[model samples]
Target: MPNPSSAVSRRTLVTAIGATAAAIATAPAAHAAAPSTTAAPSTPAPAAPGTQAARTVTVPATRARSAAGRAAAGVRTDFPIQYVGVSWDGPRRGGAIRLHHEETGPGSWQPIATGCAGGPDVAGTAAKAAPVSAALVPAGGAVGYDLRLPDGATNLRSTALDTTTGPARTTTLSPTTPVTFCGVEYLSRAAWGADESKRFKNGVENSPAKYYPLQTLTVHHTDTPNADPDPAATVRAIYEYHAITNDWGDIGYHFLIDEAGRIYEGRWSGDDGIPGHDANGNAVTAFHTAGFNSGNLGVALLGTLVNQEPTAKARRSLALVLALAARTHGLDPQAHVTFVNPVNGVTKPVDLISGHRDWLATDCPGGIMYGTLPALRAEVAAL
Candidate 1:
């Protein structure tokens, strides 16, 4: 009624002031609720200790089967089954077969009749025997066994049945197939003496003639498994290695034995009946042992013993080799061989079957193979 314009202006001013107050209040509240642009306080969960994750694994079937089979057979499952040799009694009619056992630790030889089958010779029987296993025979070791036939027999024929392959191995024996070792026909001195000169002379050419009075017969394992397992080839390779790699004239050892227990002539040819010499003023000594190379006759067996054992034929050949060496050296075959440790110069009375490690710092024959030395020597004594 007094002035409408003035009244409206006053009202608008009151409304504007109210709106400004409200905006100020809301801005403070929003600022308090929002996080600051600066770094926020860390709240990390505790970390786990440094550790590897768990894993699952599977074993091979052969190993598992062997373990189960051994457990059921009452034999220790941990040790590998090594076929040492087969034993058989011979007769004109037939023979009984048995397989000789060699356990992993130091133990006496045990016989297992489960794996063997009747065969012409122990090898044929062993080849056909169940389990279908094989072993490396160190030089001068036996690789087979002979069982006497029952009375009233003229000839024997037998075989081995391999359990793994289910195959039969058979051999027929005759008078013409004479027992041989190292590829050289094994004949009595009387029978083969006439060819000694030719054979002995041939041995000399295998290496330069180096002579030393044979004082010791040292045993060794080749450490390498022969791929071909041939005694002749094995000897040849050894000679070449010595001549080429070692810069020696020929194979250091005088003799070598294959898995079959067959012996092969090395540096000193069995034909020549002479010993070898080295470039270092040592006799053409066998290089079986590292430090004891000068006065020792090294006989290397062509196989490793990590998971395998020496064959029975190899064992027999080893015994025969030792016998020959002992006879040649004039050492008592029944007495222990003297081994002088090259490191400490400590002397030990090793059996006539001393090992390469017995005289050197290195493990020449390996643990399992060397472990059987005592038994080997005893067997040699009996032989």
Candidate 2:
């Protein structure tokens, strides 16, 4: 069956119905990037050649039992690591995975969190390939992990990630100035060292970029450790996890905001200068929301917000981005709207600025951050 999202023209869709989009491509692939103006999007382009993987290490779980008579595994990594996740070969099931960290082998252990699982919405089943459910979590730049796996699990695989290599890669402890466009300032893909070649495998893109009219703007948290050493590198690791590890061929969120209030571009919208919008001010469909990805825009906070709150800088940036999106898309940040999915016609009642958990049965965008929606909405509305 032909995809209704890709079959329609951007201009025609906007005129017929004012719907925004989250990306869901149907074709093999094309290149992407948007223009500086709120209106400019050339067709997608073919990406550059592939670069060999480096930094990401796949560690096999060594099954063990602790004194508590619970199933667990111990991974003593020798390299500098930042993120961790576990995967199984079979279908995803209900269970919990707890991770602790140590800076050295057999040193000391501290608890991190259980099932910090995050990424593109698993509920949306329209992608060309299935994404391996890696209950991904931030490793706090630790050298080892204490793992507690779910009972009766099979084909277990654990992977550790480290994007900061050495002196060669910039370990930017400070935020850089973001490029301004669409009434906001943000880091472009090139600014953050995005390897666009990853969009393709051999020669064909996994899923081409898709565009739709503006709908709603959503918020989320990366579930990564706060006070990030190199937020840019964290963004790259997430791109790798989502594009390659999850097999989505792109990052999930439309924008990622660091603790310092620097906003990095997420998902390849186009090369036309606009971040998430097409030449006509239409939005690019992203992987943030599952069945309702077509017109919802997703912006994520960089660190874990479960127990803590976002820095004032990050909150300011979030409000700025949301306000601009709401103004541009003709949305009331404080009002409720029933969103209709453009492709599948799924209907969802949502706030103009909602938490990630609003769309699916997941604790995303964190609990504390989700609770401040009313204030966030008022701030955006005021802006």
Candidate 2 structure, TM-score to reference: 0.70
- For residues 1-383, write the lDDT of model 1, one tens digit per residue: 01101112223323432343333332221100100111222333344686423221111111111112112222222323222222222222233323333422333333232211111111111112211221111221112222333355332222211111212222222122222322223322111111122222335632335344445666777665544433333343343334432334444566666666555555543332222323222234444444444445677777766456677667667766665455434455556555543322434465555776665444557677788887777765554
Model 1 is weakest, by summed lDDT over 10 consecutive residues, at 29-38
Candidate 2, run of 10 with poorest lDDT = 23-32
In terms of TM-score, the best-performing candidate is: 2
What alpha-carbon RMSD in Å does predicted model 2 have with respect to the real structure?
Answer: 10.9
List ranges where model 1 is wrong by over 4 Å: 1-208, 226-231, 269-284, 337-351
Q: Tens digits of per-residue lDDT for model 2 on 1-383?
A: 11233333445434322222221112111121221211222223343566322121111111111121122255556665566655543435544434444523343433434322333332334422122334566666566665544446465555666655432321111122345442245677765656677678878986578777767788888887788866777787777667665567898889988887777889898877677777666688878766667778999998889888899878877887786677555668898888767766667788868887887655778899999989999977775
Candidate 1 global lDDT? 0.39
Candidate 1: Cα lDDT at 95? 30
